[model samples]
Target: MRFLSLIWSNLKRKKLRTSLTILSIVVAFVLFGLLCSLKEAFTAGVNMAGADRLIVRHKISLIMDLPFTYGSRIERIPGVAAAVHWTWFNGIYQNEPKNFFGSFPVEPEPFLSMHPEYVVAEDQKQKWLQTRTGAVVGRTLAQRFEWEIGDRVPLTSPIWPRENEEAWEFDIVGIYDGAKKSTDTSGFFFRYDYFDEARARGEGQVGWYVVRVEDADRVAEVAQKIDDEFANSPYETKTEPEGAFAQGFVQQIGDIATMLVAILSAVFFTILLVAGNTMAQAVRERTEELGVLKAMGFTDGLVLVLVLAESCLIASVGGLIGLGLAWLATAGGSPAPSILPVFYFPVPDMLIGVAIVVALGVVTGIFPALQAMRLQIAVALRRHA
Candidate 1:
């Protein structure tokens, strides 16, 4: 501790230089923290998806429609407990065009039964089931639009446009909160019957089917069986675990997780150069001082420790500042999920931020410390300024 203080005081002797070096480290680490957070956020939905659920989508392409009858066939398969079919409405609010949130046409009763994770009032569920045009909004979506039960919200569809119509209206029957933190809390789910009855065409089609398996461990076998059943059919099926299905959705936006990792690696490498250069410069400027210490009976190990301590101090200061900034950014509210719903930073990401900082401190200090320790007192003293 006492030796560290000496090294710190020496660093303070050139306050501007030390501060600049620390600032460089801080910038690099802040970027590292942000990148790591982004990687976690992009894959967050997959991490949150349950193991017991499986998704059945069009085998050729996810965008292709599947027959609604597949839902009943899937439910009858052994190890399948329940199933619900839904289609992405892809609707907009008013004509603003910028307003975006998920809108899905689902069978209210069976959908709710399959996904009990969405908590809603029992009376609200009954009301939603009874009224064909009734809709349910996620908690986040409700807060964003300031929607309440009984409110008639108008939505304009791009995919299923009404003939020269401005919008379609639906009554909000409930606001649902997710039982789990990972539940997508920003979307609208309404009765498929309402949509089907309103549309003049495309009556018996669905986007995908979500199946709840009897046992989580049997998901793979059941998925294979489901695929095999539809293999020779006109509308073949692609079966995946719920997590993989969610991940496939994320992949459409490009490999965000891989991009973040690459960015983080670059930032860490930049920090390594910045810290290493600072330490190397400090050692060069204090060559005479190190020589004098060696002559005065200070061992090479002690000199190395002193130089390494200086680097550690600089890195620690920067690391803490970066960590503090990261915490503030994440705590304020996640920007990723707001702008891109599929991404969200988790707690493990924060831990990784701290770990990266600690690792940077050690890596940036070791090489310079080694160079300083190997200096020969006699040769160093003989060298001209």
Candidate 2:
């Protein structure tokens, strides 16, 4: 208790410097929090993808299409549970390109059956499947466009243009909420028949196919089997686990995770230098007081411990404040870019924040503690006079 009082007194002796140091820590940690959240958002789909699902795209590039007939062959493969195909419509709602969202032509019945994670009413699904020009929208997309269950929405397509260059129209049959939190809630699905019938060419092609395997452990083997089946075909195939496919998309944006780690390392090193200098100066100024205590029978180790404790306390308090502010900021939610729709605070990250604080405390105190321990009582007393 007495040791704590001594550390507190020393810190209170220089209020402005302590406050400024704390503020610097706050700003740095806030940046750290933001960076980590952005990285997690970009990688969330990979981390949360279903274990038993696999994605099959074109061997050369995702932009290329595959034969729609391959869908049935994949479904018949051993250990394959279900399969569905979808092709990107690449449409715009208006002239503005910034208002981009996913628009895809899908096999409605098979798609809903394979992806049970998309929550839609049974009656609504039946209605969507029965109607030729009916559409099902994601919850997020419905809110953005103010679309209702019976509204007829007209969408402009860049990839699939109509014969008269007019906008395509569809009835909104339902709005689906994602069954899982990680499922993307910002796209709409329409009938493949509606798109196929209107197309002038490329009538029997799909952008990609998603397959569910009975055993997740055999995912790699099943993926190889799917690819091998089409090795000699005109449209080649490449199959991977759903998680790996999501990760490939993130890799296309460059190595953001590695860049974030480097930035954090640089920031922490700067914090260490600032904190170490502050503690060294504080101990130097207290040389005469420490000498008096030593002459009055205080042990050398106790003086060293007192100085170290002070440095640790300053770091810990500042770190806690900074971490708390970061938590609050993320919890409240911010307007994230379309690429990072699932941004949220994670529990493991908070624990890591605490660990960083303790590390900073120890690193900044070591040199000052050693300097105080090595001070000679006789020389310190002479300097005091």
Best by lDDT: 2
Clashes of each: 1, 0
| TM-score of model 1 (CA atoms) | 0.86
- Each candidate's root-mean-square deviation in Å? 3.1, 3.0
lDDT of 2 by residue, 1-385 (tens): 8678778889988888887887777777777777777777788788777899999999999999998899899999998999899888876776567766788999887888888778889899999989899999887778777889999988877778865677878899999988865566677899998888886567888999999999999999999999999998878899999999999989999788899899999998898888888888888988888888888887878887888788878888888888777777777443543455666656677688788888888878888888888888988889977
Candidate-wise lDDT, in order: 0.81, 0.83
| Residue-level lDDT tens digits of model 1 in 1-385 | 7676678778887889888888887777667666666665666678777799999999998779999999889988999998899798887886677776789999887888888778889999999989888999988777777889999998988787654454778999999987865567777999888787776567789999999999999999999999998998999999999999989878988888677777777877877888888888888888888888899999989988888778777888998797777666665445643455433345676677667666777787788788879999987798734
TM-score, one value per model: 0.86, 0.87
Candidate 1 wrongly placed segments (more than 4 Å) = 121-127, 130-132, 148-150, 162-166, 179-181, 291-301, 334-339, 342-344, 374-385
